[model samples]
Target: MSALGVVGGVLQPLLVAAGAPLLVGVMRQVRARLEGRAGPGVGQPWRDLRKLLRKEAITPRGTSEVFRLAPLVLVATTLVVAVVVPFVTTDSALDPVADLFAVVALLALGTVAVALAGLDTGTAFGGMGASREMTIIALVEPTLLVAIFALSVRVGSTNLASIVASTLHDPARVISPVSLLAAVALIVVIVAETGRLPVDNPATHLELTMVHEAMVLEYAGPDLALVELASAMRLTVFLGLLANLFLPWGIATTATALAVLGGVLAFALKVTLLGAVLAVGEVFLAKLRLFRVPELLAGSFLLALLAVAASFFLA
Candidate 1:
């Protein structure tokens, strides 16, 4: 990679780490306003995270090192993904590691770490949450991979930068049937992966119904802050990848200052619009019953399958 690419590696994660919470805050604010009340402002997540950072950490009486280390692993892996994805500039020193499979595996690493920590906690809620989260991961991963396959088949390269570069050079691909199908498949994976509505409620404390929250329920202080921030960064990274891959209109192809600035603006606008779309969706839909979630995920797999087929056939 060039020096410019090296610079991008340092800058991309900073973008994700600093800006991710704002996306969640925006979504929450939108959701609240839609319910006909004044909502927590867009800065709410940052404030909540700050509060968690100042509190005391409360570990359970009989937990192992896994419980203590899992949050760090989760946050670390997500930051790696944030830097590796072509969120700001397609040319990045990390491009060699930005393969579609690698990105998915990085995400899976965090999930696995968190799941093991959940099991390590020895709480019924933790076990229940781990079980549910794993189930969702199983269902979500195939669709995610296949959706990547659908997109990658077109360019013959699974590299995130290559995919974005291809899409950027050919703006018309955004509207193709394969792109549309893959987009649908990915949007479903995003909702599932992010613990958004119709899958898991991020704000709920209800024991039986919560998935992600249940796993992290025992965490406090900096650990909880890291976990929350990691969640936000992961969601933002996923959305950034989605926007850059499918609608790569303003993604910086080069490492130039002006181009990068434009890319940042484009990235913000796209994710903000997408977040609004998600919040609107949450308002209209109810969470699926636990038993019915497999059906929802299975449907996602089918959509991804169609996307792959369409990519091959349409070409």
Candidate 2:
């Protein structure tokens, strides 16, 4: 790999690891401020992670090794994605793993790990949450695949780096119907996959409505910290993908230190803006009923399908 590629490979994961929590904190603070409350600073999530790490790790009774390993698996997969995705530079550290299919599978693996862990716990809420998560994933993964495929069809490659490079080369595609429809489709999957508002509220404690939270109820201390951190990182990965896929102007094309630095700054700025917008929008929206979520997801799927069709016909 080139110097810039190596630098990006190292820097991307570090930024995602360190910045994910701050992103969550920023979103929470934005929502709080919009609602006229004095919110905790952006460092609050980091503080919480630190505190959780210092606490005693707990394993619930009768739970198997799945419970113990899920957190690590979740984090491990996300970290790999942070490395492979073209967040900082187009040069992938592992080109073989930088395909759109591989990235989506890695993400799905993390989700499945947590769901299986929840099922292992043998609790009513755990099973409910696991089932609900699987339901969402069923709709989510296909839409994510089809939407990205829409972009790839025009580029003639499924490799994410190639797609990003193509977008950078043909800036006009950004305003095309295929791109716009894919963008809308991607935005919905991002919100759903990340457990954001109008799909699954990340902050809610009520069991009736819990999706992500319900699955992790048995976790405590450091394990819980890992889960939360992985969750944040997943959001960061998705948002970063969305930003770079659609508005890839500021991403570094040349292999230079200054260019890489610019890419980092651009990435952070884009993701923060997206997170803030999502948070502000959430303030004015309520979580959709569980039964209503499929309708929303199906609508997104249709958009993705349309995008794919448009890409082929318009091209």
* Tens digit of per-residue lDDT, candidate 1, span 186-290: 999999998998999887899867999989988999999999999999998888878888988877777788988887888889988998899989999988888
Badly placed stretches (over 4 Å) of model 2 are none
Which residue pairs come into collision in candidate 2?
none
Q: Give the candidate number with the greatest TM-score.
A: 2
User: In model 1, which regions exceed 4 Å deviation?
Assistant: none
For candidate 1, which ten residues in a row score worst on lDDT? 2-11
Give model 2's TM-score versus the native structure: 0.99
The numbered model that scores best in lDDT is: 2
Which tens-of-lDDT digit does each residue in 67-164 have in candidate 2?
A: 99999999999999999899988888888899999999999999999999999999999999999999999999999999999999988999998999
Question: lDDT of each structure?
Answer: 0.88, 0.95
